[model samples]
Target: MEFLLYKVHGSMNTFFMLEGEEREDYEEMTLKLAALDPGIDGLLVVLPSQVADAKMRVINRDGSEASMCGNGLRCVARYVCERDGVEEAVIETMKASLHVKKEQPQGDGIAMYAVEISPVSFQMADLPMAYGGETEWKLKPLPFVSEEIPFTAVAVPNPHLIGIVPDEYQSNPAHQQKWAEFFNGPNEYFTDGVNVSYATKVEGGIFVKTFERGVGFTNACGTAMTASALVSCLAGLVPYGEVAVYNPGGMVKCSVEKNGSSFRLRLTGNATYLAKQQFKWEGTSSESGLELAEELQEQALYEKFIEQTSAVTNRFVS
Candidate 1:
């Protein structure tokens, strides 16, 4: 069937697209897609209505679905806006309401979008970490090699653990690997799974590397960035204003504000436009005509995707 496709990178280098419906055998499909082409990174199952209205389901290359994505949301916001010709939009993901606004152009001929992420909550119940009882607060320290880094567990729509890395940990791959292993370990105490971030204090901004739960070692993560910024502020790494996060994909700006016990993070970044073309899938069958029918269904699905996102944009513009 026809599906909306995009080569999204940054945060993690996943070449993914949005499918209208859930696959019959998600695991097999995921493996197939990853093997379909060398550039096939991962797949994301999105509820255009739900995410734009409430939340989106993130399906990884391994066919495992997760709650949210930071960089992916920025790409989605831009996709919905440009495809529908809108300016401002509010997208709902599994976590919170994402307030997206179109921004001035950048150098790469790609449009920029500003997505306001949800507040940060350290409550174990909010993170819903499986191991811990629903408590008023949750915090911990992880030792990476010889360095012990203190981190706060926060949810920026998605769950995350943010820690500041000293200069020693910044260049040590072994430290990063150890940190990743600890997060993946059972003792970490996140029941619902968590994304991990390591930050280094730079002159102008902070450098971050993330180990996303569903996806590993990504360049940048929007939610994680927001979470990191707020955690940094709480830990006195940066001030409570606009925080620039340097990721491998590129740099994005996030603004934070205290909201009672929580904080709000606003993220800004560029969304690049790849080629647009028709996708045709062929199945070997005695009923060649049925294959044609399947193709028609796919095309219809793609049209529906376009139409739904278009409606979302129209509502914002109109």
Candidate 2:
């Protein structure tokens, strides 16, 4: 069967979106489709939903299904709303029924959307990290990652371990890769593995470097940025309000609100459509018949927008 596929990105966290029911070979399909685009981080398979506008199931390049993908949610939000001719829609994720709405146009052909990231939990059990008990892992010592840098575990439906480091204390990629690999592979801490991020303070914003669980050193990780923003606010590194988060790929805006003992986060960013393709799937062992249908100029404009911004220059943690 032939179907139209969309190549989309949120804060440059690229994904391939297809509108159809999921296939049994989704895991194998994810691997094959991801190889098609070097920049692709995951595959967003849109499925019909009885509870919301659509259901988004994220299959990472490594063929692992994600409970929730903040970046992918924005791209899925834009796709569903545009397809249904609406401005607002709710997307059913694996963990929650997230509310997503179209935001005012940010120009340069950028499709902006705001997604609600909630059911926030700090309990080690929620992340299911083998940290003894259900204690809220706050700014405490994590000797495994770094004894000097304190870490916090957050579950915005997606488990993440965040660390806020100073400019001079930031680590290199090889260093980050070493620790992230341990926790993600077969470690005593995260048996299921967790998304790791190291955030740094800038003049007026924050820079986040992430090692996603299934996807390694990506240009950006939406949930990681959201988790970084929230952790920054909790640690008082930044004010508890709107924050500008910059990453290697691009930048995103996060609004953090204090809610009792926890917090609520709203992520607003670009959902740029890169191109369209027509593909047919035959079997798990075969190649996905992908042909370029059309391409869009939004990616170039997005790069121009990023170039004109100061976030690119403010990147500290490399």
TM-score of each: 0.77, 0.95
With candidate 1 superimposed using the best TM-score fit, by how many Å does residue 204's alpha carbon deviate from the native? 1.1
Clashing pairs in 2: none
Error of 1 at 73 (Å): 0.8
Q: Judging by TM-score against the true structure, name the best candidate.
A: 2
The residue-by-residue lDDT of candidate 2 on 26-67, one tens digit each, is 788778787766678989988999999899999999999999
Model 2 residue 62 CA deviation (Å) reads 0.7
Candidate 1 lDDT tens digits, 9-110: 433344555646544654455555565544444555555564354245566665666566766777677766766788887776665667888898654234
Off by over 4 Å in 2: 132-134, 168-171, 285-287, 310-318
- The candidate that wins on lDDT is 2
